[model samples]
Target: MDYSALRRRMVESQLRTNKITDDAVLDAMGEVPRELFVPRALKSIAYLDEDLQIAPGRYLMEPMVLGRLLHLAEVKASDQAMVIGCGNGYSAAVLARIANSVVAVESDAALAQKAQELLVDLGASNVNLARAPLTAGYPAKAPYDVILFDGAVQQIPDSIVGQLAVGGRLVAVLQADGPGRAILATRTEAGLSQRVVFDCSVPSLPGFAKAPSFVF
Candidate 1:
């Protein structure tokens, strides 16, 4: 299979058509072999515009969704980044090309192991794969220049927001009501300020759903 051709098509059709205008992000999305990050049985659909389920309750975000978020974050070549719910490190691989270094945090052990191996195989040396709770946000590698969640969340926990360096940008698809909205929050002197960027459809990461409230 010609992965290069498929990736090119994905960039042109899914990403470009969806407003992923950043050159660096387009380059990275076109370079990363998304097939390797997905189950072998599903490799044929790896470059599709939809998300691929890489593990139980874990998904690789849709190409356009990830691309748009990365474009909005504007990851610089010198920036340090952290990806929450990295799912097989596909996002980490794409991020490694844009950021100086990336710390990928995954909550599932099996998924983390797969991500580590795949990242190593792909020569994504700049990424550090850590197995930890998704909501905890890997504080040991705190103060990142950018933080991204690869999946939707009911809310952006303070634990994750607090890990961002001043001026850092964090982006995620926030689910509420009937659908999810993509938002970007920048850490500022006053605090994190957020604005909705676009409407998105994506599954929530493992641990970010809001707990149920009591009823009368």
Candidate 2:
């Protein structure tokens, strides 16, 4: 199979048509062999126009959704980025090309190992893999210029938000009980401000959903 051709088709058909205009994102997606990130059984369908579940409850976000989120974040070449719940590290691989440095945090040990292997195999030298809880975020490398959640979350916890630099941006899919909406959050003098970017549903990463309420 010609992964190069499939990648081009994904960029042109899935990403470009959906308003993913960032040249760096386009180039990185086109170059990174997405098939390598999924289970071998699913490699042939890696470029499908939807999310692929690599684990029981984790997913590799759809190409278009990922591209749109990255575009909305406006990741800069000099930015220090962080990816929360970076399962398999596909997003981190793509981001390693655009950001000067990336710290990818994952809670699952299996997923973390897979991510580390893939990132190193792909020569994503700038990505620092952190094995930790998804909801907790990696505060060891706090003050990142950009933060991205690789999956949907019910809310952006302050624990994660505080890690962003004084003037940083965060992107993620926000969903509670229905469809998810991609959102971009920015930290300012007062507090973090967020705006919905688009509507899209991707699988929720482990530990990001809202805790169950006690019913009397």
Candidate 3:
């Protein structure tokens, strides 16, 4: 398969048409080999316009969705960022290119190890890969300027919100009321304010599912 051509087409067609206009984001997406992030069996479909399941119930977001989320995060060169569910570290590698520093958290031990190897191979010196529960944000590197959940979730726990610095921003695809919505939540002195950015369908992260309530 001609992976390079496929990747270029993905950027020009899916990404550009979808409004991922940031030159930096586009360049990163174009240059980074998406095939390297997926298992060998699925490398051929790496650039396809869909999510590739990385594990049981876990998937890497489609390129367009990820690019849009990064653009919305407004990553700055001086910003400190954290990425939740850093599956294979593709998002962290992209964030590393734009942000000053990045802490990528992954819950699956095997995936975390794979991400670490890939990040090192990619020479992403500014990004650190850590293994932790998906819902439990890395507190040791708390107060991030930006927090990105690479997958969908049912709720954003205070445990995660507490890691953000005042005035910081968090972007995630959350299940609001019913269908999934991409939301940008910002921290303020008064409280957190959330706004839905777009409608999206993404695989939910494990351990983030809301428990059912008993009724009479």
Candidate 4:
């Protein structure tokens, strides 16, 4: 299997055609052997156009979706980033290429360990894997320049939002109401400013589900 050729095809077909125009992002995505991040059985399908399941309720975000969200976040070479739900660490690997460093938090112990191993093997030295609750952003390393939730969520917590440095950007897919809306929120002196970047549908991260409302 010619993974390099397949990766190029993925960049041209799934990404460029879908508006993933950031050259740095495109190059990073193309260079990362996505197959190495997934289970052995799924290697052949790693570059496919859809999200691939990494766990029971978690998925590796589709290439275009992840690409566009990262594009919207506008990561800089000197920026610090935090990735929630760092399944298999693929997102963190891409982010490490853009940001100076990345702290990836994952609640699932197995997933966290797996992500850590894969990231090290891939030589993503700037990523720090944290096995902690996804809702609680890694505060010890707070004030990050960018924060990304790798999966859809019902609502992003204020605690998580507060960790952003003033002028920092956060990206996530909110799936509370209708179809999911990919959003970008920037921290400001006054407050956080938010805008919908696009509409997307991806599996929701566990523990981010909306609390049930009572009905008569």
Runs of candidate 1 exceeding 4 Å displacement? none
By summed lDDT, the worst window of 10 consecutive residues in model 4 runs over 49-58
Better of 2 and 4 by TM-score: 4
Instruction: Give the alpha carbon lDDT tens digit for every residue of 1-216 in model 2.
Output: 998999999999999999999999999999999999899899999999999989988899999999999998889999999999999899999999999999999988999999999999999999999998888888888899999999998988889999999789999999997789999999998988989878999888777668899999
In order, candidate lDDTs are: 0.92, 0.92, 0.89, 0.92
Per-prediction TM-score to the true structure, in the order listed: 0.98, 0.97, 0.95, 0.98
- Deviation from native of the Cα of residue 74 in model 4, angstroms: 0.6
How many clashes show up per model? 0, 0, 0, 0
lDDT of 1: 0.92
Candidate 1 residue 210 C-alpha distance from true site, Å: 1.0
Q: Which regions of candidate 4 deviate over 4 angstroms?
A: none
Give me the runs in candidate 2 sitting further than 4 Å from their true place: 214-216
> In terms of TM-score, how similar is model 1 to the real structure?
0.98
Task: Quote the positional error of residue 117 for candidate 2 in Å.
Answer: 1.1
> What does the lDDT read for residue 139 in candidate 3?
96
Name the candidate, 1 or 2, with the larger TM-score value. Answer: 1
Return model 2's CA RMSD, one decimal: 1.0
